[model samples]
Target: WRLAEKAAVTLVDRLICDLALDVDRHSVGETYLAHRPRHAGGFEKEAEATQENYGVAPEILTQSQLSSAGLAGPFYGAMTTPIGFGLNPRKYVAGLYKGAFAAGTRFFDRSPVVQINEKGVTTSQGHVKADKVILATNGYSSEDIPDWMAGRYMPAQSTAIVTEPLSDTALEAAGWTSDQMAYDSRRLLHYFRLMPDRRFLFGMRGGVFSSVSTEAVARTKVVSDFREMFPAWAKVGISHAWSGMVCLARGRVPFVGPVPNMPNVLAGFAYHGNGVAMGTFSGQLLADMALERRPALYPAAMHHPARRFPLGRMRRALVPPVYAAYHLSDLRR
Candidate 1:
């Protein structure tokens, strides 16, 4: 697991450097700042184990140190980890698309795969013959496309809001002027960051259902949480707000291997919402498998296939109660 984690970061680094991609990547740092004292100890233990196992050093900061680090609020303490950075995921993905295109990878836009057999994929546009097909879609996957994908992946909605660029005065007023990406230690976590452009991005985990009405409610809840965390910026104008699905597996691990009974096909999904890096890493692994080349890194932890959820099509019904339980657990702090 430790080696896989290290390799995941290395793979992304190699992709950016080898492809000469400009992704607006930042190497500032990341902090897991906790708001509750009980969570602070867990952070300390994680920092120690992560440093020992992964060789990335982390500093455990006291409450005063957290405030000194330009984060005001009722934080108990924090564990600031090195070698982790922030990047513009859109730019990174666009860069990948351009690089792959330049390398002679043909793309068919709006051609959703309606069927996948041993020979190729059939889309609404037409059928494309291929020696090997890879299913890379995570949250948007259709269960019936391969039938085996059903009940093996769960999609949950996550919402985020970006504020209009904050002025220096507002930054100081809120005491959150750092460019470091940070999140609190809560079961229902809130990940936030002050982007290079000075816009604050705040996101939260929840939303079992996805719909026009549910999205509005999720946006409202995220805004409420953001305001509660940073009261000084409660009146800030929000420039953008949106929601998207993040995939999960019942096993709580990712799956990257051949689709059952499909010899010429491979599928990878269920990143548990940490897709940017892990997805890239999985793509490399799948490519290696397709090419019959030895994989640079493949951990036994992620080698197993994902298990099916109990409720099948009704698996979404299971999320709300689990989310409610997490909410109640978070309230205990």
Candidate 2:
């Protein structure tokens, strides 16, 4: 958690310094509360230490404060920046793509890579070899290409749902006036944010497999959880529901470097759901490596070689049991 927090804060600081995009960031710190009283003491102590180290106090909010923030909880503590911020991801990516296109970057859409070697990639259109091949395939990577990459990371599923635009009165009724993004302190955590359009986006970690039935079950659970969290929005219709895979590495950190024994074949992946900033930053590091530029801003851990999963070919089959264990542990939390 410390490493993750440091990586996130560092990336956010770099973004702010570069003026990369209008992140729509807010300093309204996130609240971390639990329904169980046993969790409060540990959280309070941790929050206090974090506040002291970061110079941003983690206020121990009361029940009224938590309620006012649209959080359903027994009061605990809240941490401020550099942990609190919000951004419009769509606009950020769109802007980057537009700029890249203008800079004469020809995008070959729908040309899926069938094979990758040290030289280049063989796509659906045909084989077009090059001097170096950069494998940026994260969660969607196939096992066929570069046998070593297979089973190197666990691709876990994450689900999200968004509600129809709620009115100001509806927002107030839900006690959600703050624009800050919020998440709980569980291993299988729930993340949610109120969009500028008045819609609420809720997400969670579940759905070990990617299938219609799995997605349906995940959606049902997420919607139920959302309703439970914000009773005022219980009747609100869900506008969208979706799910995607997030690559998980052994150390919970991303890797950006040449594939072992295949130096020219550089790869960058395994962000573990922190792809928005970590992915972009890793892309830059990969580019630097390809271009033979200076060293990266991040530590060597960010560029370490990925450790292969022990299950090998049966890795995907083990996802369900792993998810169940994590879910059971979260239930205890």
Candidate 3:
């Protein structure tokens, strides 16, 4: 929390300095302090609206900060997938949009759309009647969503697990204190991060799961898959494992903002793993557009949901081969 907040403050300080063509970094810092002066008293601090950078924090590379810092990828602001959201989601709850308290209201069945509005939540199932409609469903989508949208999104499942707390010795070995979340560059990655309680929560792409596994059932072979990330738990049994349904898109980017057609009715879904923030950001945009209000501060071209994908079990069959080829390509690269 401290480091993230510090980074945010520094970012703005530097940004203002850059914007006005200030000469020195320290000079900008002094200006920032003067305008947004802080009193090291009993007051709470502010957080940065957004974070910058894509690589791991400097301190994290206890062994090599200087080199590792630059020997990395650019930040997409996607806390879910550091490699960018192509086929996977980031590890943590990098949610930018916190849903409104009025989430499950009756507003969905009306104007904005005639059928399958923002969410799959609706009272009617028959052919929807309205001026126009949009298919915002990503993975859990139904045939009811427009033919175009259905073609665009391919729903898939992902699994995640929070591990047993880390031991003091384990922490010493890992050497990371802050819980900055991280995920890798694979279509299926074992991305994870630290928690204040010292537990390492890990997540990855799991094949379809039809039934739920109890805690006892889940805890059976826990240490195997993730032991490589932290071999310290070789002998420690896995406390638990659980699975859930997550969506994936054609390119993995959320179909935010607006597109050419389907006016009055706006669409936003297919978050890939960027759903949290993307959802919030998209939802806010949707609400503003619906309310006939324009947000001064937000991204343009965000409400546009992707063009849908074709329906069929063909997706499932083709996915294995496609993903395998993709992974093989990665190996070669």
Candidate 4:
């Protein structure tokens, strides 16, 4: 976890200094708000650990302090960690893409990798042979592409909704005008933030299937949960709603190392939904490994390979029962 913190810090520094990409909707600090009394104690423990380990002081907010922080709901208390930040991901990625192109990185669009081997990869259009290859594909990975990816990663769906820009009066009514990124203390958590444009972005994890009808159902579920969490915005119109897959591993941690039995092939995935900074950090480590150089931040957790999940291709069947248990646990007082 400390290494992950370092990765987040390095990511922020590189974005501001090395890339020099000025983007909007970027702000530091986050609060892990607790909505239940049972969940409040964990915040204090987290704050103490963070401060003691990293010398970074985090504030633990009381119930009254929650209101002062511009969050309105049933939250009991919170731990505001001043480590990470929230940004417009689309803008950040665009800037990164432009910067990489400027740095002479060749990009081949419309070419989906069909196979990967020690020599290189075979894409839909043509085969590109190289001495070393990196399999950075996360949730969209194909099981048969390398055969090693099967049962080693799990793709879970996360849905999000964006409200129409709220008026000052609306924001005041909700008492949630702050722009800090925040998430509740639930196993299946909900992350939200007020963007610079006054739009409220709320996201959650309840999806287990991928289809048109299932997507609609997931959207409805998220919207319902959003309205339930913030009653003041019950009537607010959602301008947009979407869902995407995030990779997960059996070990519940990220893996960034060479593929088993394939020395020239390196793979990195399973960020558990924190693919922004961790993904960038993993890419750097992969590059270092490819060049046979020591990485600046290659922790033991990351170096450890991910074990394959049970039931092989049928592993997705494991989600419903697990989600059901999580839902029941979150409902407990």
TM-score of 4: 0.96
Cα RMSD to the true fold for all candidates: 1.2, 2.8, 13.3, 1.4
Which candidate number would show the highest lDDT if scored against the true structure? 1
Candidate 2 lDDT over residue span 72-97, tens digit each: 43335443334645666677677678
User: Would you list the C-alpha lDDT of every candidate in the order shown?
Assistant: 0.87, 0.74, 0.44, 0.85
lDDT of 3 by residue, 93-112 (tens): 11111112234433343333
The number of clashing residue pairs in model 3 is 22
lDDT for 84 (candidate 4): 76
Q: What digit string (tens of lDDT, one per residue) describes model 1 on residues 136-214?
A: 8898899888888888899999999999999999999999877788888888899999888889999997786779999
For candidate 4, write residues 72-168 as lDDT tens digits: 7779988878877887777778888998899898999899988888789898999999889998889878788789898899999999999999999
Worst 10 residues of 2 by lDDT: 73-82
Kindly report which residue pairs in candidate 4 clash with one another: none
- Candidate 3 local distance difference test against the native: 0.44
By TM-score: ranked, best first: 1, 4, 2, 3
Instruction: Report, for all candidates in order, the number of backbone clashes.
Output: 0, 1, 22, 0
To one decimal, what is the Cα RMSD in angstroms of model 1 from the true structure?
A: 1.2
lDDT of 4 at 54: 75
